[model samples]
Target: MMSGLSRSCAVGLLAAATLLTATACGSGTADTSAAPGGGKPEVVAAFYPLQWLTEQVGGSDAQVTVLTAPGVEPHDLELGIPQVTEIKSAALTVYVKGVQPAVDDAVDPAKSFDAATAVTTIPAGEHAGEEHAAGEEEHAHEVSYDPHIWLDPSRLATVATKLGERLAAADPAHAQGYRDRAARTAAALGALDQEFAQGLSACRTKTLVTAHEAFGYLADRYRLKQVGITLDPETEPSPTRLSEVAKLARAEGVTTIFTESLVSPKVAEVLASQVGAKTAVLDPLESKPSGDYVSAMRDNLKTLQTALGCTA
Candidate 1:
């Protein structure tokens, strides 16, 4: 019943309202907004370890949002639109390069902090000739360096210090707070590193057999040899590889085969039965543990000590 001109005007008004709504929401650019009235910088942590580290370094000065949820495997985390937008809007995104391909793709370089950059990285373990399951080839580690830097308390201490500086640079008003927290976090990690050094100093066996190659940093830090069943938990080890590892395990007197929470225990169980060794849970910490980082790591230390037959 309306005239053409009226209809045109109505369409124009609707378009204008839509545009205004979008403007109110936001754009692709970073948000950089302080949290409510607290003026805390918004930080995005890619996973559990980074989340804990960020919380320690940022303290009251930062509001951290963790991308990976507890008990979820972080290696194949798929980002939703909201998560991508969150990465864009956050003042800083803390992640280790090559851990999650989706996170690596989503983060803006200028607003992101790669934790691996803070420490000297070790070479990734070789998994040549290892056969993968269907649709699991994409999960293979593509980076030259292993991305599990958080396993080493000493290296993680370095990351905490650097993260504090980065946060200080981002939120200058809270620079002192950030620095203080960083120092405290670094000190805590340093103490943990000392504990590990002392506890692992007199182990009867130094061979650490794991389900996945997620503990290279830990092995490097403690001077232990890690024998991984596969490069990735999703990757199925070839029979040849399994037989080779089992032979090595028998020769080296490896009493325990380690499995993680995220990965299935069947592979480890089979390998253990083959080598006449027992299977134990050795958390890689790719996901959040029941306790906080420190507690979980302490638990890990205990597990390692027992498995290795450490005197201290």
Candidate 2:
């Protein structure tokens, strides 16, 4: 899939780079079209990750509708009335606050399971915000967090707990089921976190270069330094910036440049070739994944282990 970031890099490549909206990348592919049970209420997710969470926690008690289509970049998403209707009519709507500006405009903040409410985020402009000042200092080191919270399993587990409660409230008949599912999902996420800690514990290098900045949470969680080729999905970095990255890539001995399943690999390919490094697919879980959340994440774990040369 051609991700918004890759597209930006292709055309914009440091010249008047544009910023990609948070939804620019579609996430994991899960079976979201499952038939609802009798009285199984409707739950509308803003994107793939939310859809996956609701699907897992809600199980058979809810019918999840993900607004983002496969292969479609969610960034700069201009939603129509039909999609708005889906959100307005659903028994519950869950989304990240800053992920899709369109969703924020259409959905009521008080009623939705907003992930931004639960997780600390990087400064708005760090990734999705459009008002970031353009200058040489924009790339300076900072402690701001990115909004891709689900990349960190512990944060996602927190979201699952809160979303499960919301589901229970919406579907009283299956309240216990919702709670149980949340507990199980949290346990699984916890185990995944443990695996990552153990797996990445002995990596030869703690640096990761990705096509976009979606891995902030993941890198932070796993103690890896992330160098993104395109942090702003809509715009490409400046030539000066690219040159700096290329130089840093050489200095860091960064051997891999990762593209994603949802985004275009062209930018990574170009950059990898420039750096004399190999390209790999490091999914950020941005699309309607071909597999469920756990499987998708496990695949990511294996890829990370291999790419980072983890001992475990």
Candidate 3:
């Protein structure tokens, strides 16, 4: 199996190819021809989750495309020339500000498009002040706020609302259509939130040991505890740290070791073997998924319910 970084790079290349092919076939929305009867606006999203959400809000009245593809890690994604061309051609663009810095770098801030909605994450204050400390680093590339904001149902609602409003402004002809879709999507998100609350409410264990700190928002929302994996999301963990985590899991009766989809499961597997626990893959929205936000959260909730042994 490829390491997490290699997998990310491979996925990025695949996305680049797909976008280029679409452009080459003349099937992309970049065509300058006005919409049929000049109806429905065109919107582009930086990644899959946002693309799904835009579709929900825009309904049949809008055309939406996600720059990233399934299984591709969004954090490490780079926009190819074709992808940049797509963004520049869209009527409106929706994206998470900190999650995909490459797209951010490619977009021009000075030019006024029909609309540009970037979801600003909850201040690190929401995460107990971890943001500033993480922000001080001077790297060659721009560091972003944890782009996992969509993991929280409430945050997803906020993002959808903002995107809906932007879409309405861009295409007044479809304002009602966008509004209706947003309402439905928000309601669906609320229902999903209740499922998580009810399903995980009575777990015998509240503390979750995971592959990274990606679960901070989920943990906070559900009032569960989190112990990070040996490695940060970006790098491998040291052997000593892995050993320590295994020891802690054994002592704490951590029945499930949570791994993510984009990362190699070796570290989690090793830890699980040492602790006599099972490993479960929890998605952190680092990659594109086959389904929309609600569907993804449902899968995640089912995994958490099983891992935590929730009674409901």
Candidate 4:
């Protein structure tokens, strides 16, 4: 009954309105189980990376929420009332185990919820390397293999596969959708892996020094060296420690000193000054921006490449 252009415009408007309504209601209630008579399945992811992974596997069919926001230190965060409420209401809660011991203390594993996915064990030791200082209480948590398993492309695919299965089991009607999304996410992660391999293959200095020991997993997966980490992940190093690291940096010929956003770079800066090198900020998956998993990994790869002086 209307002109062609007018009809198209009307359809576009209707679609936009529908999308707006859905968005306003929030994507946190997209579970297939939550149909007319069924309730929505709410998902709570502990951190940004996991949240991104779950959302990719669940797509628009499940409502996914991330408790940790950008620039916040996941390991040191404590849950507030709002966050606890969100977790309590979620049908499924996904978290990278051991990365945040504080979280484990806050939530009861048996009583919090019936379905919880602790993706990787805390203090995951798989990639921590053998050089971890002896009798260091700090490394105690690093025993679980590497909580940062998401950094490994192959491992990330495994995670996506697992998440797909879990999501499908939780909501059978959208099982195929979850599977497809997982496959797509896996492919994207594979491409990211290739990019990192190619980009860092020819780095002049493979040794990395950082504010925290967080990069142990990344360095191990990429075959890079981690020279040392600051004593405290959050605090500034003492003058004695700073001088020691500076001497170590110069002795090792380290070109760049890396620090994360959530931690102070004072010690790293001192070390860099002593060694006449530069300082760069690296995100250790403590928090992530709004982009999807692949995009965030790509950004991290770029930062690492620049810091390491990789050719590609």
Candidate 5:
């Protein structure tokens, strides 16, 4: 019933309002540098491992963006508007559900592969030092299950298979390439698993003392016992707790203290000094983009072998 002129004016106003709303939402200091669009399907990984696996499978067929930066701890990340926008626009998002709550909020569930659901998960801090493992789940703990699935090469190989299927589905033109790449990576991982099993067959000690509960999956995979200094990586241990850990380290005959690359080494240094032990780096492969997961994990295997005195 409205006049054409009036309809034209209404449409103009609606378009202008939409523009304003979009502009407001996307305004100011937004990271547009790695915004995902360049003909190839864009993939966004919640953390580094996903990014690496995607890169390996995607192989010039997809553009990948890793949300967590190198050397930063991913436990307490808050996604800004820029990252949220990136997630929404990405063609495929690969993430471990419950790892980063903010990333969960930003990604469309229907459009993502929640890798936590893709693989088996053990209780978080389940193998952490006895003092911290109370079979309790709290809001502050953030995630119920450990999100460090990538630490286990076999599990990562499994994920790579699933992810390859997803990638082939997304870009059918390069489907064979994705499958081929994934198979190669999966084979390499299988060999790594064999190596861990064989290499760890004759270790003098099987107990692992770690900076946090990050190594539970790796330890569990290789049949090693794990003890962690703290449940939360970012939290500073109270003086009392620190002393207790030192005492426990000595009592348990924990000879090698392991520190995470992302966290400070002070705690490990102090504990090692207390227990008359040496400190080593055991990367969790979460935020470290500079090091690929396989290579870092290989380095971790070497460190474990040396620290645990694995023979043959």
Candidate 6:
């Protein structure tokens, strides 16, 4: 997260470098040329999950570039000159609007697709609007609704359908290819959603206490309750909040306290100890996992089954 002055400074620097950095962003995967008429549309994805989905839907017909690199927290991303250029030049940019403030500022409305618009969004977590440390305040989750819609495979399937349409509209030459791939991707996501439904149909506990509130959509999809230690991954919960969650976890018989790779686990570990629960990793898909989206989500399903004592 960036402070007000730092964010303003970043915006000014980005504007200053717009004409200078004509090359593409270099930190992540190979940068695709953002030039016109390559027989493939150049697309920019804001982060990992969006990157994976864009690759799945775009297939070989479109050139996709991801802004956030592997293992980098999306919220903390500060746009470089090249990335700003990439977003401006790309035919389309796929992103969740509230996740990355930098990307939100850089993207063109007419060219970019905000994934949150594709689904019915839930309210932002209780702590979302609260004032935080200087840098954390007014960062991610400042919006009225949560933007982590990709957690629900069903919602992502909807996004796939819409993205395919968007891509087809952008590059009408490969319209059939885009639509076909989108349908296939949607079918695959539907299958994954079914697996989650059946796998978590009968869990021992419905309450989910996580390090952060990134899983709200997933909880909504599967009818589980998410009690997050904090709203933003960058925000630290107060001792009072921790104690409150610990007491609630004990009452709900929560056996696991979930954490993620990008965020520190100290708070989760302490809360787990206080509640006599074990700690487990629950990837929010904010960053690239060891495996791709489908495989990583399947891994999450297995983790949830074990943690929640699901029959499946």
Using TM-score as the measure, the top candidate is: 1
Please write out the lDDT profile of model 4 over residues 239-300, one tens digit for every residue. Answer: 55566667767777788898777777877787787789998877666678657667767887
Prediction 1 TM-score vs. true: 0.89
Q: Write the per-residue lDDT of candidate 1 for residues 121-152, one digit (tens) a residue.
A: 99887664546343245655457898999999
Going through the candidates in order, what is the number of backbone clashes in each? 0, 24, 0, 14, 1, 0
Flag clash pairs in model 1.
none
Q: What is the TM-score of each candidate against the true structure?
A: 0.89, 0.80, 0.77, 0.75, 0.82, 0.86
- Select the stronger candidate by TM-score from 2 and 4: 2
What is the C-alpha lDDT profile of model 5 across 1-312, one tens digit per residue? 999999999999999999877544432122222333445677889888888888988887787988987666786788988888777777678998767878877788766898777688888764333335432343343577888888888898998888898888877777898999989888988998988888888987888888887877888898988877777575555566667777877776778999977789998898788789999988888776456777777788898899989896
lDDT (10s digit) by residue, model 3, range 1-312: 899999999999999999776544343343423543244456777777777778888888887778888777777788889888767667777776656667777665432121123444433322212332343342225333444667777667766776777777777766888888888888887787888888889987887888876776677779888777632456556666677677777777789999888888887898888889999988876566667577778899898888887899
lDDT of each: 0.87, 0.74, 0.70, 0.68, 0.78, 0.87
Candidate 2 vs candidate 6, lDDT winner: 6
The reply for model 6, stretches above 4 Å from the true place, is 1-38, 128-137
Ranking by lDDT: 1, 6, 5, 2, 3, 4
Clashes of 1: 0
Q: Which candidate ranks first by lDDT, i.e. highest?
A: 1
Order of candidates by TM-score, top first? 1, 6, 5, 2, 3, 4
Cα RMSD of predicted structure 5: 6.3
Q: Model 5 clash pairs? A: 129-228
Q: Tens-digit lDDT track for model 6 on 104-198?
A: 89989998999899889999766522323422455634577888999999999999999999999988878899999999999999999999999
What's the C-alpha lDDT at position 138 in model 4? Answer: 58
**Worst ten-residue run, lDDT, model 2?**
22-31
- Regions of model 3 farther than 4 Å from truth: 1-39, 109-144, 230-232
